[model samples]
Target: MTTQTPAVRLRGITKSFGSNLVVEPLDLEIGRNEFFSILGPSGCGKTTLMRMITGFETPTGGSVELDGKTVDRVSTRERDLNMLFQSYALFPHLSVYENVAFELRVRKTAKAELDTRVREALALVRMEEFAARKPAELSGGQRQRVALARAVVGRPAVVLLDEPLGALDQKLRKEMQFELKRLQREVGITFIYVTHDQEEALTMSDRIAVMSRGRVLQVASPIEIYDAPTSRFVAGFIGSCNLIDAVVESGRVVVPGLGAVPATLPDGTADGARVVVAVRPERMTLSDQPIEGGFAGVIAERVFLGDEWTYHVKAGETELTVRVPSGETSTALAGLPEGGRVWAAWPAAAGRVLPADETASPLIGSPA
Candidate 1:
């Protein structure tokens, strides 16, 4: 755990299965004590990359360095790492304390030192009182804590988690999100978490590496990843974004169906080349009166969300959703009903333009 070099580094790493490439040559540097996550959809090779880091899978090309030393030839067991599977993988017969202490016993640590470490690990996850309970008798969250305790008890240099919260219910999963973050800070160990859940990645990690098609798309903090996705794939996959097809005319983006809207374009974008503008629902506002720099639409439907009222509006053939504060719904809509004319507006900073195609469809059905 003590090192000046990165905890893990993958330089020009590539892996293939026969003719199909699972992971393209990619370079990544993970800092010491950094809670990093590798996120992507199924078949995107997130798991394969994590396996290579833990020494469970060999790279067909390139190499993996741990603490500045190449460990591509090392065995999984010999690496100073611990991995918690999606399945808790706890021993049913062993008590939580025994499960946490099992690793110490394997290395023949002293009895006094083993007990002290086990208790500390259990307390770190707030599961010290349930130390005597077996995995079968504990709740999902409790069992998850036990698994975490077991992984951290041996003080591994890095802990790899493969969707540890995927097994829990929605409420329990949300609760465990904070719990895991707290545990990471308390133990001060580097955590490399892999998951396809976007919300989970945004909620827990210090930084996220968004991947697709076996390549890393963008690596940044949660805010940057969501606000400034490097490509169309990252924008659409990370969260809910209203992607409108547009084209760059001069320097501004001219959306065909919705007219020209201010947007940021990448360098060397052709004047008539097709592009897309991504706008989040939360960034939009609905009103009856004309506002500065806002698009006009017709109200098509309305839904009541707990703290806000969502109005689906049609801008030509495209439909957009706008969320207004619960208290301002009546004033905002001004008695507008289905088919009533209105305006959906937001600042220039709210939208980002990118390369677009048929994939940028509206969440709400477009007006006929």
Candidate 2:
């Protein structure tokens, strides 16, 4: 039996600028047709990693492979990959059709094939009607589509997008997120997306690699990444999580102000081990009435989000944030104003325990 090669592979890849270590040694494999995201804050080396894969920068160690072929010394043009940027680098004077056709022209493709490919690429991005329009005449979203058409017109083996949607407004960015995913599926090619937006990564990625200080911390599906973050940084960075410092005793986590809460100890964790209990804000429930084994607090503040309201409850020294859905629904905590007293409750399975020391914590992965 033969094994299929991954679409892209990085083995022991490391990069440094002079004496400054930009990326730590890392190994990663992206499967065929996968929408993989490298997420992190600025200066976390995600863009540098993308550049390494594009042959724009050479790695200090190890190799980059496309379909199992090492391409450490390959020129950018020779490698089977295409890159799309945030600025949508389209020629100001060229029509969208010519922009998409420029790549094929350079390759000396047959005229018939070039015309067909350009039109097909334009059609794929739903921009065929604007083929004759110059880049200067198009809207930002339209320009983005034109650039996307140009990127995939040559049908490269992999596409590397470096914060491609960063320039768009929030509404347009959200729209393009779905569009980007749809286009990737239709093209059936590997997509390595680099972004610093957490919501953007969560919305579109098949798997996310969360990076911090040049190291990949964790790589997993979006659901798993959100629900099962392995480190304190991952827990705090991925979403709005309540990371309560606590100590484990008798199979429960004892928070400084919130008292004890049920938690499933990770393997090898002792009774007196210091840990942090991570719970998503939305997982916590607030009741106007006191309940058994629940923490009591007064609302510190209330922020009204369109679809939901976030209630910040102050219980002793610990403050817990709860997300309550909007509308006059029975479950909604509508009349609970700031300074209102309430009790917070969550099932035992809601909290995930992690080691207290961040350095003792493990790696995590991602773009935003």
Candidate 3:
């Protein structure tokens, strides 16, 4: 459990094209052997930031660092990094073995050494048997595995993956998530992955840098990013949440639809100040009897989802959804139906009060 120094760093990173400032100046760090992800919606600048890191695109301002040394002057090939693209970028005529060995050959490694490294790389990805097959001969998932094997064969200081699993089927993509994580751990290299897929980032990252409008909103572990988001954007983007308008008073916040939630009011959280209150669906409880520190709502709809049931309820002008245990709760929810009387109760501690101005913000970017 020892901490390691960062393998990569960026400071005041900025990118702009014509009149458009695509990415604002930002700072970031990637720890050695850490599986980090830069995630956001398309056009949010996650890719732009990554391009700067991989040296495919130069930053308009600021510097890029590797192992504490400034690398802005170095070319991509000289930077000790390899990138796997979303397109796979394999040579059409080259067999998988040749494709994986291209870089080794380019460096003029001895034939004997190249054979050993190429075979080891294929074995690392469990694709040694498919070396004779061309890219077109393999399935999309298999081609992706080949690309991964090729990227790691060089033993670069870091690996950058740009939506590497985008073309695979849902089940295969899910399977590859675990596979990629295992590979990253086995190699012990700094892995900087970029994706717009929240689930993918959450599933594979040691820490995620959630970007929006060309800037990072938060950098934290997946669980911390999901459970204790610093902004309304992070709260709504990482998971399902109910954002209610509220007013602060006496160290508590009174939500419009829900009641007062127990919370601390820092010096800036004034009495009567407007704010937004966030509550997760799983944190709430539905009960027949009224409970302390809870709100009441009518059940609007119920949908069974295999192991669990989702109950959608409307309170005032807002709709609230909650997931409960399947069997018995499914029957109870079915009986409740749309517009049926019911109470939605959640612990006061389950809700977080935030500044009202940020409630409408998207999960990826800045404050609303």
Q: Give the top-scoring candidate (lDDT).
A: 2
Model 3 spans > 4 angstroms off: 1-4, 262-268, 327-331, 359-368
Off by over 4 Å in 2: 327-333, 359-368
lDDT of 2 by residue, 1-368 (tens): 97779999999999999999999999999999999999999999999999999999999998999999999989999999999999998988888899999999999999999999999999999998998999988899999999999999999999999999989999999999999999999999899999999999999999999998998988999998899888877888898999888997876679886779856667666788888888998988878889787899999998989998888889899888888777631443567678888888777778888777752453122122
What is every candidate's alpha-carbon RMSD to the true fold? 5.0, 2.8, 3.3
Best-to-worst lDDT order: 2, 1, 3
**Residue pairs in collision within model 1:** none
TM-score to true structure, per model: 0.93, 0.95, 0.93
* Model 1 regions lying over 4 Å from their true place: 1-3, 266-268, 332-335, 357-368
Q: What TM-score quantifies how close candidate 3 is to the native fold?
A: 0.93
Q: lDDT, candidate 2, residue 178?
A: 98
In the predicted model 3, the residue pairs found to clash are: 275-356
- Please list the C-alpha lDDT of all candidates, in the order they appear: 0.85, 0.88, 0.83
- The candidate with the higher TM-score, 2 or 3, is 2
